[model samples]
Target: MATATYPPPPPFYRLYKDYNENPKSIPEHPPPIEGTYMCFSGNYTTDDVLPSLEEQGVRQLYPKEPNVDFKKELGSLNRELQLHILELADVLVERPSQYARRVEDISLVFKNLHHLLNSLRPHQARATLIHVLELQTQRRKQAVDDIKSGEKSCRNFSWSLSEP
Candidate 1:
């Protein structure tokens, strides 16, 4: 009787095991704080630097600027920034850079951004669903290739030896 040989473990098995063992091992960054603040001691007024400062969570500390509209500006700026990142992600996925050694990293970035957008805009659930489906399709193709390679190795081994 002959025993069937199994293929070696996949590269991602270690990652899967680590994830399953400690799902919370990844540290989460805090949500962005929105505030307006002064930049320089020159002629530039606080208003001149408020928008950029608020985007980075540096709001005015003085009571005189009590009416500062940081929240509104931050909301708009956050949305715009998110959209910009999404556009850049799309381009990267479409034509990955030759210097990128790990294409999966880029894919994960897109996946996270898609999730972020979905959470921010529940109305776009359908579009998010489509994006996830596409990612899954790509993963499926990679899995199929692995299986095919394993099968070829088994076939070659079986044909090379004589009956015992």
Candidate 2:
């Protein structure tokens, strides 16, 4: 194969050389290159950067699901919670020493449950708030009872309460 040679590269004129050579070559006012800076700097409008929740096929928690029954769902969740609490109580009855460790797990489960409840129905977020209040009341009662019975120290009984 014969060796191929490329032609000389085009010359790059100094600042405004072309403009000086031919004043009319460059328009007095060039059209703005829309978003040229933004494109170069990786900056994009909200629509360009992130697809809306609706566009992403994410159904809105509220009005989108018109057929959703909030009362029924909440009732079911309440039942499940009752069952879990009963199970946790049974575990505590079986092993009194496991209170501290078991309570942490129960707290985490409730946190997730509260998140689910809020996400499913923002209008019904009050349910989670009420539930959290109930939990706090229950925990406070338990702590007081433990303190009265001298089973656990009031000083050592540290409860992390979250307001939903």
Candidate 3:
């Protein structure tokens, strides 16, 4: 009998790579505002929110079926949106010549979309923003520590060079 070789699991880094490489491959749903709404005084997951909209003849923008892991899925969606914004920013920053005007226009559109996504769920949006800020602060502190350690090593190296 011959042993079979299995392919390795896809890396987490490349989970979004396909979509990033060809965004158009993923069908674009209309913006969330196109959906119908039902006012609820209580908390609701994306699943809870979908039926009401569907009943009102509003198409659900999300490709996933209901009862999926809303929290994780929503996080992934938000992450994708943020990545899109960052990619646009990078393009804008890199092209200071002919693309400047185009960059400005796309950047403004990105900002509006980003703002709309964030505004959809106020509490969740605030929490996500806070989490991001905390992570950024931690990264900055680590960077500062690394620089200080490097400086100290350099200082010691110079002192040793000066001695004897």
Candidate 4:
């Protein structure tokens, strides 16, 4: 079989290259991801401005995570995110200037993923607490059993010594 080669990714992806691995790197002060930086370094150039969330008019699709299965929804979103990422990267490579819409789609997917993961946080926390409590309870039971055995041994020794 012949080997296939691929081209490198567009420079635009550098903006969020670390986001999945280190979400904390996302700038906090700006609601819409605006920042002061050079034109080529993922920030917008002077003539072209990155749209704000207000400009995009973003709104909650649902007040809370719907009754749908979370794992399924999460999987769907993960795939959707990958698709949007590729679309954005491809557009940047081909049309460069026409990346605003693609960027918007990618950001929307990111927001959805963020929401889904957050909804699962409470459950993860509760599970961890339950596991710790269960382990602690097991340890306590073991300690009690050991103490009882020691008491029995002491009583047997006393009775044996007292027997004439």
lDDT of each: 0.55, 0.61, 0.61, 0.75
RMSD of 4: 19.6
Order of quality (TM-score): 4, 3, 2, 1
Error of 1 at 37 (Å): 47
Model 2 residue 4 distance off true place after TM-score fit, in angstroms: 89
Could you tell me the lDDT of residue 2 within candidate 2? 68
The superposed Cα distance between candidate 1 and the true structure at residue 58, in angstroms, equals 26
TM-score of each: 0.26, 0.28, 0.29, 0.51
Better of 2 and 3 by lDDT: 3
Candidate 3 structure quality by residue, lDDT tens digits, 1-164: 97559866667645456796787665556666433455686543444332333454443334435354545545755675676567667766786455565555545444444434543675687889999999999999999999999999999999999999
Weakest 10 consecutive residues, lDDT, candidate 2? 155-164
Cα misplacement distance, residue 106 of candidate 2 (Å): 2.8
- Candidate 4 structure quality by residue, lDDT tens digits, 1-164: 96559877887667777999999876556555444556556765334433433355764333343475777777887888898889989998999999999888878878766766776777888999999999999999999999999999999999999999
Better of 2 and 4 by lDDT: 4
What candidate 1 gets wrong by more than 4 Å, as runs, is 1-124
Candidate of highest lDDT: 4
State which candidate, 1 or 3, has the greater lDDT.
3
lDDT of 2 by residue, 39-122 (tens): 666865533233334664443332335465756655665675677688779878898776775676556446545544655664
Candidate 1 C-alpha lDDT tens digits along 1-164: 97659877887556556566788764566665455534585443333232333354443222224353544544544665566566667767786573253443444444433433433454366779999999999999999999999999989889877546
